[model samples]
Target chain A: MSKHVAYTDFIDCEEDVRIRAKDQARVVALREKKGWLFRLLLGLVLIGPGVLVMIADNDAGGVITYAQTGAAYGIGFFIPALLLSGLIAYVVQEMTVRLGAVTHRGHAEMIWGRYGAFWGWFSLVDLVLANILTLITEFIGVTLGLGVFGVPHVVSAAAAIAVDVVVLLVLRYYAWERVSLWIALGNLVFIPLALMSHPHWSTVVSAFSTWRVQGGFTPAFLFIVLANFGTTIAPWMLFFQQSAVVDKGLTVRDIRHGRVDTAIGTVAMVAVAIALVILTGTLVHGMRGASNLDIQQILSVLGQRLGPVGEDLFALGLVEAGMIAAIALTASTSWAMGEAFRWPKSINMPARRAWRFYLPGLLSAVIAAAVVLIPHAPLGFLNLTVQVVASIFMPAAILFLLLLLNDAAIMGEYTNRKWQNAAAFSIVGLLVALSGVYGLTVAMPHLL
Target chain B: MKKDTLSLVARTDRMAPVELTKAQVKGWVRVVFWGLRVYIVVMIVLVAIGFARGQI
Candidate 1:
């Protein structure tokens, strides 16, 4: 018995030493593999959704809003407004990445699981309706931009729809994302367009320093400002990123990469937004006042002010913005529908495998295109409807997001830290207050 | 026989119960969750009112 006990102890000691050696070797291997360059590359690969969401958030409507703001107000108040919005967009989207990565679930699923069927159905209806309305605005942008080149609205609308379809269908997830990113880069077209305008550099700098709200904040200006804010951070962004994170197979480990991606996107969005405002502010604002300067009018003004090349560039940027945002909104619609119905919902899924998931997006594109062809359709009214619907739905979307982010059962170790909640809540409160104030302004223009 | 014993041990390990009762919702989390619920309900009511009043 004594001899047997000694032999067992010796075997156990040998096994312990072998395990320790293996563990040390693993540590060394991990350290070697996760070198800074490798990590940087990995982060780049993981950055698509956040940046895409941010850029797509700066869609056709957002571009026009920034342009109008600059043209109407010059760079006085809007430059600071854009900076504040960029901060708010980052805070809101970062929470989505965390929720998605930690839970391995889409926002819809979490809402349904935690809040029961009533709220789940409510959210689904809001997302679908809002997505459809938003998609229509994207078509409006494309058609209007094309009009600058004398292309008929029908042709441009068809082409835009076809491009979005091909992108979502032919390209797998990674390839589709790359194509979208290329198109999104076209947003930077405004930067050169702004430069061509030869904006007074000193005045631009002074605007930032003054952060002046000239004309003393009339209700009209306040309404427009709030509208601009609503455009920047819409309800669709939350749904889109959470679903994108799940589709990309991100986990808690990828949260840092996701955050970095989001930051890059936020920076790009702000740059493009500021550039668009500068383009319009320098060329059109002081001259046109707040008069009815539709997108085409802005383009014509830009052409006269900065030459034909600038006009062409501005039109192309608008087209690209509309196209990229349409693709995102379509995908967001598909994703939300798939999640709500429990259908297969990944770009990774083959068409045959996920036909149901692709159908909603396809139908929405077709319907939006059809709507553009209707005569005397009050296209502006459609755009206004999208904004108003988005405004109404924004609070509910944000509230659900906060709930999920704070749910320990869902988020596990990745629940919102204190600062994140504070920032998110502040954004929610600000949005609610702005929407309310804007509603009042619209109702009683002279009240404020 | 020894192989059978090892397989039995693995199966038994796999069948161990997870301690569900140990999981507790912290007080702050409860507050945040309820707070979010209230916020959503309030917003929904406001939106409905706005729509009814044709102000939305």
Candidate 2:
């Protein structure tokens, strides 16, 4: 009855939802026609958002915290703590997969739509502020990491910006995700560096059994532990993963694969953190009475103890961590804004089409990069505030997450079980206590 | 010309009009809400006291 247009002609379609639907149908049809290998390959291909969010959780900020943990506490208390965090990360992040699959909405959108404007604005404002502050720390990581290679801060910042722009602007969603995943893989570079340190395996093994704080539970010890906690689970992570799942067009069928992806990411994150702690613990432990050595000092000590190659590798890991976080955080900011305002949001859209959607993220990255270049910018103060701010706001983020996860009409059968709610609330309680203590330590040492 | 438009696989409207029902946070869930709220407030007040006294 009519002419048939090639599928490529559909590229110009304004609504991306149609493209996603058609693509999903095609995949489903292919699965029916093709054998098991094709389905296996499809399954492999579908697991991005979960893995990406988990790996990205071990961002620049997280790396520094891990290094400090290793340097300050040795492989004693934090070794088991890392494993605990991985579990916490998995339990918390798995909810996002179900939410995205069930609702097909970003965290910001869900909050605004269901919980009224006050909560919505609160979440959005907290997310954007934390993302921007954290992005600055990421740039700081990039600059400091590259500084090891004698790269100028400006040059490194510019290069980082260019790489993020290319990845964000030039590539479509699928390609961009692949690129980000590859960069995230670079985080594993810490493993070999840790091996190079030749840590005492028996001691590492005993750390699990002992679970003892080397310096006892002093104010400093508590701070590092809380810092590790703050970095492991952040407000940005919740926004990033939900929007990522929605953007990836993952259906309810894909939620299991999503959980597996998150689990993989959790393993990777824990392993890297453990390695960093061991490496620093072996090399720089008790240095300067182990009073929270700066990252520069930590890297320099690595150079001296493990030689130049070790330092360079550690630096490379830091740079990769920063770049990966920068990309994820920028996208997170964009997604939240897009979701909040109902803008056309998806990395698949061309620059011309989604400029407004992409603008907030780009601007955040740019400002973060610019702030790093300012002379005497009080970066330590910025870093401190980012951690403090994330800590302060984390409870609210977790509360909203629990609320949405438990909502019956929206989540239907996917709602969290009662035990899951108990676990989540327990985590929230623990985090609030840790943050409250850490906040006082920072905001007022006299109390401690 | 005949054109067939593919329907949205995961429609946004599914979540668009939904709002949390009244009985959402009954039982221990309500307790959790109150507890979490108090915990956050206590943390804030402690930090505020610290600031007021210039201990930070």
Residue-level lDDT tens digits of model 2 in A218-277:
777777778888888998998999998887767677788888888888899889988888
Which pairs clash inside model 2? A443-B56
Proportion of native contacts present in model 2: 0.21
Q: Which stretches of candidate 1 lie over 4 Å from their true place?
A: A1-37, A288-291, B1-56
Candidate 1, CAPRI quality class derived from DockQ: incorrect
Top of the candidates by TM-score:
2
Report the TM-score of candidate 2, chain B only: 0.56
TM-score of chain A of each: 0.91, 0.95
DockQ of 1: 0.09
**Per-residue alpha-carbon lDDT of model 1 for A360-437, expressed as tens digits?**
988988898888889888777677667767776787788778877776765678888999889988988898788667
Worst 10 residues of 2 chain A by lDDT: A1-10
Report the error of model 2 at residue A110, Å: 0.4
Cα lDDT tens digits for candidate 1, B1-56: 43333232232121111112122435775575576567556555655555676554
